[model samples]
Target: MDMEGEERIAAPRAVVWQALNDADILRQCIPGCQSLEWTSPTELAAAVKLKIGPVSASFSGAVTLSDVVAPESYTITGEGKGGIAGFAKGGAQVTLLDEGPETLLRYTAQAQVGGKLAQLGSRLIGSSSQKLATQFFADFNKAVVARAEQSVQS
Candidate 1:
């Protein structure tokens, strides 16, 4: 499956870039993220719980950041296993565009599933992925803007 979208954050590119690189902010923003630990500067270990249709599973994965250009763009790739549920692997290219007072965050991603997850039908899995990605960015945007507001006030 393939997915792509853009989000406009009410913060400058610098602030948004900081948020994107911060693991704590990502853990808070990602849906069902149990934990995310930085194993290296550009590598992270992740645990995520996902419920698609009637199946619920916890996935353990590794995420790597590559092709990085600070405060601009990077490519991220991850693969996870969910025991009996199956496995998923995907990669995304993320770009941050400076839009004056706001930042335009765009991503293009491709994913593949195998075993039980692949058995759940393409539509169901695709929609679930789309929903999760949407929620993550929305929550992230809110968090980033809220911190920006707090800084301005203080």
Candidate 2:
């Protein structure tokens, strides 16, 4: 499955980019994330509990950041395994564009799944993925805006 979207954040690109790279901020923003840890500068490990329709599973994953251009753009690739539930592998490319005092964040992602998840039907997976992705970005945008406001206040 493939997904793409853009969001305008009320913050500078550099600030938003910093938030994106912060493990704690990302853990808080990610839906169903139980834990997120940076194993290295470009590598992160995560545990997430996900519920899709009637299926629920805990997934362990690793993400690697590459093709980076600082506050401009980067590619994130990850894969997760949920034991009997199934597995997922995906990659997303994100770009940041300056928009006056704000930043325009754009992302394009594609994912593939196998095992029980694959048996659950593409329509269900597709819709659920879209909803989860939307929620993640919405939360992330809110966090960035809040941080910007806090910084200004301080």
Lowest lDDT sum, 10 consecutive residues, model 1, at 128-137
Local accuracy by lDDT, each model = 0.93, 0.93
Give the per-residue lDDT digits (tens) of candidate 1, residues 1-154: 8999999999999999999899999999989999999999999999999888888889999999999999999998999999999998988899999988999999998888888999999999899888988898899999999989988999
Report the error of model 2 at residue 137, Å: 0.5
Q: Model 2 — which ten-residue stretch has the worst lDDT? A: 109-118
lDDT of 2: 0.93
Cα displacement (angstroms), candidate 2, residue 74, comes to 0.5
User: Candidate 1, TM-score vs. the true structure?
Assistant: 0.97
lDDT for position 29 in model 2: 87
Candidate 2, residues 37-153, lDDT tens digits: the string is 999999999999999888898899999999999989999998999999999888889999999999999999888888898899999999999888889889999999999999999
Each candidate's clash count? 0, 0
What count of clashes does model 1 give? 0
